[model samples]
Target: MQQQRSLQAFISRPLLVPALLFVLAVGLRLVYVFVTSTQNFLEGDAGRYFTMVEQLLTDQIYGYGSEKSNARVTPGFPLFAYSIYSIFPFTPNVFRWVHILIGAATVFPVYSYVSSVSRPLLGWLAGLFVAVYPPFIYMTNLFLTETLFIFLLTLFFASWQWMMNKPSVWSVILNAAVLSWAILTRPGMLPILMIAVLFLLFTRPARRLLIPYLLTVGVCFLPWTLRNWIILDEFTLLASDSGNALLSGAYPFFQENPDYKEMYSLGMSQTQYGVRVILKGFKEHFLQYLSWFSFGKLYYMFKSMWVSSTLNFPQLYMYGGVLLHYLTLLLSLISVPYLLIKKNFLAFAFTGMLLFQLLFIPTARYGAPFILLMVLLICSAAYTFWINRSRKPNYKLPAGSAS
Candidate 1:
């Protein structure tokens, strides 16, 4: 009896479950890395990132191919790669090991946010879901911004929630700093800062700290902006990739029509050309464009794990991931009404972020970082269901009274 009580106490300890989840997350990512280590883990944008890092080290430039400096991509991931290569030998696998640690660490914010608002069991489940989620595990073995960006993004959400609850100056500053880091990692995150600002403006207790938050974020971004001004000879804010992204997104299913390609080749600036193409497409095919930008993008973004085709995985793992993703999606759908009825500000912020992503081309890679939010929503719904079920009156038929 004493042993049973002790075991229950140990299990119920506040930190034990999250710690276990963290260990589980790390173990799974490590296993993935080891299993896929022999495979070609570097593909797609990994090459460009490596090239940028090489330029950063050798020539102190930030662009590809050594001729000139351009802000094709944000400096965050390149800088991160630079730091890693500076200390360790420049190898993709070396970065994979680091990413494994980072990918696993993301579990903390998910656990913290969910557990703070709901039961600890829900928090543990959310953390476990992320820990075992295939895309999160798979991305760690590849050289991409997803692992680091997702970590900062989740941390930002947790910090934002903390500020909303307590409304402290320090929390606001922390939130801003995390968000600034996220923006550096992915320029698409800029709109989230705007959403956060609007959130603060409407939130009474946090209204006063808005200036500090903005100032902190501005201060964080100032150096990068200045770098663009001095080095690239333009007053770019985050990155110069947006124009190309817009062009890519302008096409239905990202399948560019030949006429659109010809128009782009005709010498307009990328931004102007992309805007023209998008406006022209909308004018010509309003319904088609609308459907592509809305449900089509959402479907592609959340459809599958964005793992590299080069990496080898057991077939069972892939199938399990698909099943888990659909399960989370279904649960999130159920939670949406709950979030709306509760007026959950975080839900609003997340929705704004998703809507903003629709302005660009979205894929599973883009959606991978936000999976934890889905898991959080799932947990919230599960907790609500559990609580409602627990509270129901349990009246049994009196002895033989039931007809």
Candidate 2:
């Protein structure tokens, strides 16, 4: 009895929950990385990032070696990978290990932020979910930006909430800095940032902070913009791949329309081509476009069980992970209405994120970025259910008191 009580007391320490979760998160990711490292060496975007790092270290040049330097791909991941390679004896395995550590450390920000606003139990639940989440663990082994981007985004949201509560210029700058790093890692965050600024603009009390916040964000992106201008001779803010992403989205239309080939033959830029195809698809094949956007893209975004050529894991694990993801998703839906009614900013931010990402090409990998938010919603739902269940029914005592 004493031992059990001691164990409970230790676990109840303020820092213990996140600390334990971090250890578990690291252990899980490290094991995954160890297993997959033997089977897969950098492939797909992983290969490109690895090669870019190699080229940067040896040749002192950036970008995929075949082409001249351009803003076609964002430099954040390549730069990150190169920095790791610079410190350690360069190997693909080294990069994976570093990311494993990063992926594990994410638990701190996630748990700390949620615990501040909600019950400690719910906060631990959110952190634990993130620590063991299969998609997040799987991505840590890859060379992709998902791992780093998610970590930064978690920090960004946490800082954002803190700033809103405190309303200090220092907090605003800190939030903007984290957000800028997130955008650097993945331009997908650009839309989410716009949504946040819009939120500030419409809220009467927050309107005063909006201008400074926007300016700080803009200033953060200036260095990258200048780099792109110098190298690519273009005034690109993010990457030059937005058009490619749009083209990927309009793939069905491209297959059906013969005129797309003719349109492509014109000397228009990729962004222009992408826009023209989307407009044409909407005008000519509205039904197909609607179906593709609604069902096809949504399926891609939410799919959790699909196999990747890159990672070699058992089929059973994939299916199990998918089942868990679906259950959490359902629970999240149940809780969202309640959150909105309560004006929870986190839930609002999450909804905005989904809507923004939906506008672009939707992929499970892209959706992985929001898995932390999904966990929070699930925990919220469960907490609400438990609170409702545990409430005692009240009985009338007015007659007895009067007597």
TM-score against truth, every candidate:
0.90, 0.87
lDDT by residue for model 1 over 1-403, one digit each (tens)?
A: 9999998999788878888888888888887788654544667677777777877888887885344788777777888889889899887778888888898888889888888778877777888887888778878877789899988988987887788888887887899988998899987788788888887789787789889998999998998899999877899887776776676777888676435556657877666777887788799999998999899899989887777652456778778878888887787887867875766766666677788788777888888766677777767666767777899999888887956
* Full-model lDDT, candidate 1: 0.80
Error of 1 at 87 (Å): 2.8
The pairs that clash in candidate 1 are: none
Over the stretch 118-175, how does candidate 2's per-residue lDDT look in tens digits?
A: 6787788778877876778878877878889888888887787788888889988998
The number of clashing residue pairs in model 2 is 0
Best by TM-score: 1
Model 2 score (lDDT): 0.76
Best by lDDT: 1
Evaluated at residue 385, the lDDT of candidate 2 is 62
